[model samples]
Target: MFTNNFNNFILNTDSYKTSHWLQYPPNTEYVSSYIEARGGNNSFENVLFFGLQAYIKEYLSKPITQSDIDEAKTIFSAHGVPFNEAGWQRLIDKHQGYLPLRIQAVPEGMVIPTGQVLCQVVNTDPEFFWLTSYIETSLLRAIWYPSTVASLSYYCKQLIKAGLEKSADNLDSLPFKLHDFGARGVSSYESSALGGLAHLVNFLGTDTLSAIVAGNRWYGMSEEMSAFSIPAAEHSTMTAWGREYEADAYANMLSQFGEAGKTFAVVSDSYDLWKAIDNIWGGELKEQVKNTGGTLVIRPDSGDPIKVVREALQRLAAKFGTTLNTKGYKILPSYIRLIQGDGINPTSIQKILDAVTSAGFSTENITFGMGGGLLQQINRDTLGWAMKTSSARVDGYWRDVYKDPITSVSKRSKRGRLALVHHQGSYMTVREDELAEQNNILQDVFLNGELLIDDDLTTIRERTKH
Candidate 1:
């Protein structure tokens, strides 16, 4: 759940981090760090800034209690790592246990290009200089994972958008085109919640319910159905009915959830996919499917995605008939559609789209439910995400900090206090001391143990439109 820390900031970081208090420069009072996604792939240049507020609300909002310090001391003492008991005690006594940090960032869900700073942090109290970097382990993890997932989802949207524009009449169904089936595919419930919410930034349909809980608890979306899904059947539900009753199992699905305006999904590849689509769905249940007045999503769980989808669409159209849009692309009946939930990623999706297009069908005839490919296939280095110290103050003097490795110019970090601003129409990372005319887009999000900005999903969703 990622909340097993007992709300303890004292034990949240790496064990080696316990000794950092003794390692800092003498009279070190201030330390500054910034998080960025250095652009590697030209295609993934723009990224959605996300999940900092979740970390802030979940971890940083709570203070380190004396018991936390006591527990941390015991853990570190035996573990041979130095614990800052005095510093933690001072936090409880003087600051009421809140973190002395000033966090600034571009608004959540804004898709800014890479090589720009998305978030920056500095210790508010000089005494807690080590605190800024100490929070890096948690802070960077929060941003990188969700942000990377959101970016992958965003690029998927662009792919679907382009496909729809070329092969469909309108983009009316764009949001629900790519549905999330990644809840069980992730490593943890918290990862599912965080990654699921990330996918929601671009699309509206999902099977991941935990995303809605996170959206409400952290980003303040509607408590009810932050992401929507329809009644869907898995392999177990179909197989439990046995192979002989496969037709009956599908018929029961239609009887149960197939009302007017209510959509439902059923995995159709149980025994024989062609037999299920041809004999069962199109032949036997043809009249019922036409009369249900709701959309029936047929899922193909195995076989070559391109061949399965193209053949399934042709088979469905052979029985049910197809309507042509103004653009003249083949459109399936509103009551019927095809979904490919296996091995779905952008490359496979594009290949399947190419096959669909070649077969004279519109993209409207298809929906995609991506599981692990949508959520777990990415990592921190997927977009070159890093949080690095850019500035530090020692004995009343400030100096820019950075690393310039001769081996890799791309690994070089930024120097000086940073500000994210829009200069000449695009986002840019610049030095705060050197900038004068341009307005900094990075706003104070959290400061001195208090949240400075509270943004809901509605506001964040609107930002993605432009």
Candidate 2:
């Protein structure tokens, strides 16, 4: 379906991009561009390399067919745009429809600092120098958002880990700390799938089904263990029982899923959060909850998350009693816990944890489910992502090329061929020519329409383990 779409094959780039003359300097035969996260959101150092392998497999695995060229020619001609007919024909005749470009990238899932090159691209054939930038326009667009989402998720993990270190006995549950509930909140299925998989790079809990499919299909992960979610109730199911029978509704959920230590979540804020928790849940259904050998995860969907989560923890602790963990923090009874799914993001998550610990509760007493903030509410600027030409070969000489917009100093681009190097316990961006071959961390991830690096989900997940 993607290959047949004429727009998908072409860059669908800026209107000026249609003219080859506008893309390169006179006599330019080859151009090189590097991609980076240029510092934004005060979390630049938290950005991690992810989603490149999946992007390559999904978008660049197949070569451009003859039909693709024909479609491009038709569209350009219809719009009276300057079409590179000779260049297109040459690619068809010599390269057999495959893109003649070399893409080198840091290994997927590596934690790299900001302003360092994440990936570099250059056309192998001099005639296709314009193709390099043109292709990057799409590739960068496809990658930056998911990469940002992954970085945001990783940053959340670091914050949660810190809180857990102080408030929990063990950090083993860190992987399930943040759950992806952003599937419906995102714009499309593709967005949900990509963003959800990105979140999985750092943590394992997810309610996004498409992400699981994406992991299995694109990253060679098994559906059984790639991502997981527990049986849970939503507003419709709980509200259907009516406000008068709210207690019965809670009883039904526990009765159905409460078997042999099974775990489930019930949305408790559909009618009255406090009344339902006190009268219905802690009052009427207390015996049923205690008898069932299962864990009941109470979800407070609406309100100030920090206040609600801490209050829910306190009430649960008071009703069921609490046990002190080895870390000297109070843990909720084995059969009860809290989930705050409202207003969750990296910053808000940290705030909630701070409140939880300050209120004498362990971080393990609650888990988080993020929606728009996790998947849909970010953009390229979230991490200051950009791809710009750093060099070009003209008249048998490789000359550095960069744009230093005087108005915006931060928009300045790098110069010369680039390589990411690990030095002094951190990754640094340096000119490729200056570095010895061994120090370069960038690997050949793609070449001539073939994916050179295929990373698995487990490998990527392990990279964020620390």
Task: Give the per-residue lDDT digits (tens) of candidate 2, residues 310-365.
Answer: 88888888788888888778998878889889999877888899999998889988
lDDT of each: 0.90, 0.85
**Best candidate according to TM-score:** 1
Backbone collision tally, model 2: 0
Give candidate 2 misplaced runs (Cα > 4 Å). 1-7, 21-23, 222-224
Q: Given candidate 2, what's the lDDT at residue 396? A: 88
**How displaced is residue 347 in candidate 1, in Å?**
1.0
| Poorly placed runs, candidate 1 (over 4 Å) | 1-5, 40-42, 222-224
TM-score for each of the candidates: 0.97, 0.96
Q: Which residue pairs clash within candidate 1? A: none
| Cα RMSD to the true fold for all candidates | 2.1, 2.0
Residue by residue across 25-65, what tens digits does model 1's lDDT show?
89999999999999655368788988988988898888778
